[model samples]
Target: FNPKLRELILAGKTQTLSPKENELLKMLAEHKNDLLPRERALKKIWGSDTYFNGRSMDVYIAKLRKYLKEDSNIEIVNIHGNGFRLVAP
Candidate 1:
């Protein structure tokens, strides 16, 4: 994934992501194998972690999952009431 280009090259296919998606993915990549607090991501990317913003972040998470699904070894695991972690090689 290239943050500057907002490009994800998966399985030899290229996918372009939205600005927010790029930001969120970049943040997750930074925190790969570590906990990325939901509040932290919301505030950093969405500017605030309101109910609506939290819900919006969820949607983005699902989208990110779709984009990353081509890779069987990578996962965005939910920490259930805490945060998320990017599990990857």
Candidate 2:
């Protein structure tokens, strides 16, 4: 792993995270304030877009939100029927 990535992982204070949670946070950090499409997350992380997978993604999203709650400027906003945006200010 790159030293910078290691530092970021350490700074996040994440000892361990589920696969979905780790991928979600990685994408969010990559996009930052940009929109992160739901379909993209589903396809990339879960590898499918079935109803069950969608629900699982929701669970992961909720978990990420909880983990990032300490940063007031960071938020995961749902763009009803569209996607989510990880806003950082």
Candidate 3:
């Protein structure tokens, strides 16, 4: 996690992320080993809890998962009907 550059370096490569993605990553990182409620994340990041926005968040989450997949110890688990938890070594 490069706080200054707001970037993530993995597998000896650097990835530049969009502002929304960065914010989402930050939120998950802040929550770390805790559960981040779906509605809460939606409201915080997209300013709404609409179904469309929820779907958008899911896309962003998928992107984050792809970015972090290089590390075997990192995972984003869905807590069906609830939220997500970011687990890291």
Candidate 4:
């Protein structure tokens, strides 16, 4: 993950990320293997925890999952009504 470039390199391939994508992924990576609270992420990254923003986050999460799909060692676990966990070796 290169925040400067806002891109992710997995399996020798690079996936350029959008601004929100980068921020969300960067936050997740920072908390690698730990829970990143939904409220925290929404507030800090989206500037609000509104329902619409939360839905937007879900979309970003799906995109991130697609980007990381090739790597078996990495997983993004959703904590129901809580947040996300970036599981990686």
> What's model 4's lDDT at 72?
84
- The better candidate by lDDT, 3 or 4, is 4
Each candidate's clash count:
0, 0, 0, 0
- Using all chains and alpha carbons, the TM-scores for the candidates as numbered come to 0.92, 0.75, 0.87, 0.92
> Alpha-carbon error at 89 in model 3, in Å?
1.6
Report how far off residue 61 is in candidate 4 (Å): 0.2
List per-prediction Cα lDDT, in the order shown.
Answer: 0.90, 0.71, 0.83, 0.91
Mind giving the per-residue lDDT tens digits that candidate 3 earns over 43-81?
A: 887885354647777888899899999887888888888
Estimate the lDDT of model 4: 0.91
Model 3, C-alpha of 65: deviation from truth (Å):
0.5
Across 35-55, the per-residue lDDT of candidate 4 in tens digits comes to 999989888887843546477
Task: Write down the worst ten-residue block by lDDT for model 1.
Answer: 48-57
Q: Write the per-residue lDDT of candidate 2 for residues 1-89, one digit (tens) a residue.
A: 12234222333564456655777778877778888888888788778445554756788888778767766767899888878888887
Model 1: residues >4 Å from true position, as ranges? 48-52
Superposed on all Cα atoms, model 1 deviates from the true structure by an RMSD in Å of 1.7
The digit string of per-residue lDDT tens for model 1 on 10-66 reads 999999999999999999999999999998988888784354647667889999999
Which portions of model 3 show Cα errors greater than 4 Å?
48-52
67: Cα error in model 4, Å = 0.4
Clashing pairs in 2: none
RMSD of each: 1.7, 3.7, 2.1, 1.7
Measured by TM-score, how close is model 1 to the native structure? 0.92
